[model samples]
Target: MTDSDRERWDARFTGLGPGEPGPPGALVGREHLVPASGRALDLACGRGTVAVWLARRGLEVDAVDVSPVGLAAGRAQAPEVHWIRADLDDGLPVTGPYDVIVCQRFRDPALHPALIGALAPGGLLVISVLSQAGDAGGPFRAPPGELLAAFGGLAVLHHAEGHGEESLVARG
Candidate 1:
């Protein structure tokens, strides 16, 4: 991401305030799949909602984002989480064999393979993205079946596409 991209995100997050930590969108009804004790990585973690949630569940959490302002808010909410400041465009900064990985509201096809490779045995992956499946198509939205096409090799736990969103939960 460029400096302007970071600044744009920082500005947006600054207005949103410190967001409440919550379960990942894809894990809403499948929360039991989350490992009780293991390491987790939250990509494009924004205000660290999922990262903080994982930490509270006894996992060591790493949350990455480009916005310093966003990280600060999350840091205040859960100081235990390792809040990383980096652009995802440069690829993942932290090597991983994480027991759980989450990417919510962010879609980057280039990162999908890396995400799969980073999972530990039987690790869980929870991801959600805006989609064109049940809405007007757009450049920023994933095409139909995008999640399954990208992650079908995994042991799919759940998958849904509708209401302009797509989500997948799988075990590696």
Candidate 2:
């Protein structure tokens, strides 16, 4: 993302209320899939909700997002998380052999390979993003089966696209 994009996101997040703590969407009912002890990374972790959630679950967590306002909000609530401010357009800001990696509401095909590579063997990956499959077309949305095709090498557990969203849960 460009500086303008970062500024825009910062502004938007700065104007928002506090973020609510919540588990990652994919881990809602499948919480058992999360390892009880291991490192996790949350990319585009908007206000550190999931990052905080993972840390509370006994996993070391690193959360990254480009917006400082968002990071600050996260920091206020979960200071335990290692928050990294980075423009992912420069590529992933943190390296990892993570047990759990989540990228929600963000799409970037270029990072697909890195995301797969970052996972440790048998690690879990949870991803969700806007999709054009069942929603009106948009420049930022993925086409049908995008996640399924991009991360085909992983052992897929669940995949769905509809209602303007596409979600995937898989293990490496």
Candidate 3:
């Protein structure tokens, strides 16, 4: 990301106040897929909602984001989750065979492979992002079949792109 991107995100997060914990957007109705106890990674974990939720579910979580302000907000909610401030433009800052990995509202096709590789056998991967398939086209949105094509090797449990959102849940 550019310097402007970091500033933009920092300002955006700085403006936000505290928020309650919430489920990962892609795993909302499919919480059963989440491992009962294991390590998790929440990439681009703005404000740490999903990270905290995963921690509450008994997973050791590492939440990564570029914005320190956002990480601080997340820390307030879930002190147990390890919050790491890093620019994902450099790729995932950590590597692991995690039992669960979540990336929400962030689209970086370059990291798709790394995400899959980070998953342990039988691990769950949940992702949600803006899409252009069923919405107006934009620079940040994924095209139709983007997720499917990138994660084709996984055992896809659910995949959909419409209503301006693309989401996928798969097992690795």
TM-score of each: 0.96, 0.96, 0.96
Worst 10 residues of 3 by lDDT: 17-26
lDDT of 2 at 165: 89
Looking at model 2, report the run of 10 residues with the lowest lDDT sum. 15-24
Superposed by TM-score, candidate 3 places the C-alpha of residue 28 at a distance from the truth, in angstroms, of 1.6
TM-score of 1: 0.96
> Which structure among the candidates has the greatest TM-score?
1
Pairs of colliding residues, candidate 1: none
lDDT of each: 0.92, 0.90, 0.89
What is the per-residue lDDT of model 3 for residues 1-172, given as tens digits with 9 covering 90 to 100? Answer: 8888878888998868756777876777888888789999999988888898899999999999998889999999889899999999899899999999999989999999899889999999899889988798899998888899999799999998899998999999
Taking all chains together, the TM-score of candidate 3 against the true structure is 0.96
Model 1 C-alpha lDDT per residue in residues 43-105, reported as the tens digit of each score: 999988888889999999999999999999899999989999989988878888999999998
Tell me how many clashing residue pairs each candidate has: 0, 0, 0
Cα deviation at 35, candidate 1, in Å, is 1.1
Off by over 4 Å in 1: none
